[model samples]
Target: MSDATLTRIAEALERLRPAPAQTPDWAAAEAFVWHADPDRLEPVAQVNRVDLPLLLGIDRARDTLLENTLQFARGLPANNALLWGARGMGKSSLVKAVHAEVLAQNLPAKLVEVQREDLPSIGRLLSLLRVAPVRVLLFCDDLSFSHDDQHYKSLKAVLDGGIEGRPENVIFYATSNRRHLMPRDMIENERSSAINPSEAVEEKVSLSDRFGLWLGFHPCSQDEYLAMIQGYCAAYGVKIDADTLRAEAIEWQATRGARSGRVAWQYFTDLAGRRGVTL
Candidate 1:
């Protein structure tokens, strides 16, 4: 080929190569994730959140979470929340549902779920969100740590609202079965082995105190469990007589040897499937 033609071809190939995307000004997005390797904020166009009404049996906790979330949405000072206590008691569900409720009201806040293993990346996440236009809810579900895991230190720093402090636009919400966000055995072991047993317990116990809001979820009574079932049935338009529903629900709870929102929902799903209904 002629030199001129080859040069023209090379120029065309270079033009065809994609240019790097601009580091988006955070104002353009309602939600984003921190991509650590690239050290950039990736915007999320759509979020998967449940409506608040669907979550039942935790009304007081729900109201508290909703208020805290709304305050954050409005650019008011809000505290980090630790939703702790009974298993399957709608702690995590409440956070997602509250996010949806606030968003439905046309609030600017967005929810970003970070896996428990991703705790160490929180500072990076906060850094990206600090200058963001929209408020952010950084949620970590089932967030307890074991004795050997030191990721909690990073979380502690993030929650301490470090030198730069937790980004003004972002708030942290975590759900765990343990109040301390650590296993009893792990805490106990530290107490047993440390030079100062009291200090050892305090070191681990203090992690939970970082969260200003502590919402505890207790086990629901039988009536509350049934109410949850009834609510689900009614909401889904599942047709079942009350007596039959109660009987089956009781049997299901008995077999599981426990009754919680999770168990109730599982039973409802099974019952719906058996009845050839969709939920």
Candidate 2:
């Protein structure tokens, strides 16, 4: 073909292809949201999270994650953490809170949340974080893999595989209701379908094993739940008489048919509203 024809084809192909993702300006914010469609890091000037002390229950979890994050921020060796357990027990909240506390202590660290759906773009996100001027905590909330989802492979690669492994300056934290990062049925399906049942189950659930820290959150007791409510009330200055507060909190838990840090927060919001207090 003539040079002109070849040049025209090249131009058309370039237009058809998607634009390369923009490198993030990590210096702009302490928290960011990674969007994969356009592949950009959306800066968060303020993250939505309660103070670490406000998270009353899960004291063990709070302390453990905080120490791990603090070490990572201080340029000390720290392991990637997987916060997995009971729903609404503050798995995700603890991650954000820990990040905030670490920053408040003046440790150089940033939090960049990548939604569970964006696992496929983990490599791209890591590339942006790799060159960040300060240490980064790459967070993913409510993360789990299903039977047919191969995105887990990408996560596996980013965690520990291929030539460019996880960046030393970056650590990953994820929260899930599942300990294995896979559904029970999915694990069972793999066990039944594969020739080697044992290997299949291990292969399917092993992504979680990559994490050095496994902080499991169990269902909170009634007392723990009430403690969360009390903590919120004290922090936000929600004033309700002790008797009324206890009665209302009990009713709230009864109505919800569950007790957890999330349920406690919801009850506190309701109580504060009734008392004409803003949270």
Candidate 3:
């Protein structure tokens, strides 16, 4: 071919090839939110999370996650974690808090919040992180799987069971309302539909097994709830008499119909607002 023809072909090939994926400057922020459409990381300048000490009631869950994140930050061995349990018990909050705690310890770690719907793009995200310099926490909050949902399969393989495998520098942490990452009814449906009932249910439930650390958060007791309220009050210096605070907290839960760390924080926020205190 003539030199001009060869040059034209090379230009045509360049146009046909896809553009290289662009990752954000990881140093821009301590945390980011991953979006799939643009396949980019949105820097989270401010992460809305309570401090580690402010996380009350779920002490065991808090401590375990903090320890695991610390280990990961220190470049030690750590497992993928599943924080599962009751609603409004601070599962997501704990993850953010733990990341901050780890950073305070002088270990370099960055957090990336990935939505449940972004699981399909998780492989691409992993590919980017695999070559990045810093250690990252890939967090998915309020994660759960449904009967028709196949994104969990992608997550399962990336966590441990796939050819590409999980990136060494990335740790996956997810919080779910369901312990098994699926509803009982969905599992039952699989049982009824599949030829091998046991295997069918096992296949879905087994996703939880990929997580080495399964931290469970339960509903806080009245005292525990009150303790959470007090912790927030103390942390924010929302001063009030012990008797009045107890009475109001009880009334708040009674009207709300449930008790949890989330309710406690909500109650505290209202009380602080009325008292003209801002945290």
Clashes of each: 2, 0, 0
Q: lDDT of candidate 2 vs native?
A: 0.86
Model 2 residue 98 distance off true place after TM-score fit, in angstroms: 0.9
Q: Which of candidates 1 and 3 is the stronger one according to TM-score? A: 3
lDDT of candidate model 3 versus the reference: 0.88
User: What value of lDDT does candidate 1 attain over all alpha carbons?
Assistant: 0.83
- Tell how far residue 186 is off in model 1, in angstroms: 1.7
Residue-level lDDT for 32 in candidate 2: 88
**lDDT tens digits, residue span 78-177, model 3:** 9899999999999999999899888888887999988888888887888888898999998999999887999888887558837767888999999999
RMSD of 1: 7.0
Q: Clashes in model 3: which pairs? A: none
CA lDDT, candidate 1, residue 179: 92
Order the candidates by TM-score, highest first.
Answer: 2, 3, 1
Clashes of 1: 2
Model 1 ranges with Cα > 4 A deviation: 1-50
lDDT of each: 0.83, 0.86, 0.88
Q: Residue 270 CA error for candidate 3 (Å)?
A: 0.7
TM-score, per-candidate, Cα-based: 0.85, 0.95, 0.92
Question: Considering TM-score, which of the candidate structures 1 and 2 is the better prediction for this target?
Answer: 2
lDDT tens digits, residue span 1-279, model 2? 999999999999998775667877878888989898778889998899888888876889889999999889999999999999988988889999898888789886888889888888888778777777878898989988877888888888667947887899989999998999888988888878899999888876888889999998988887788788888888889877878888889998899898888889999888888889997
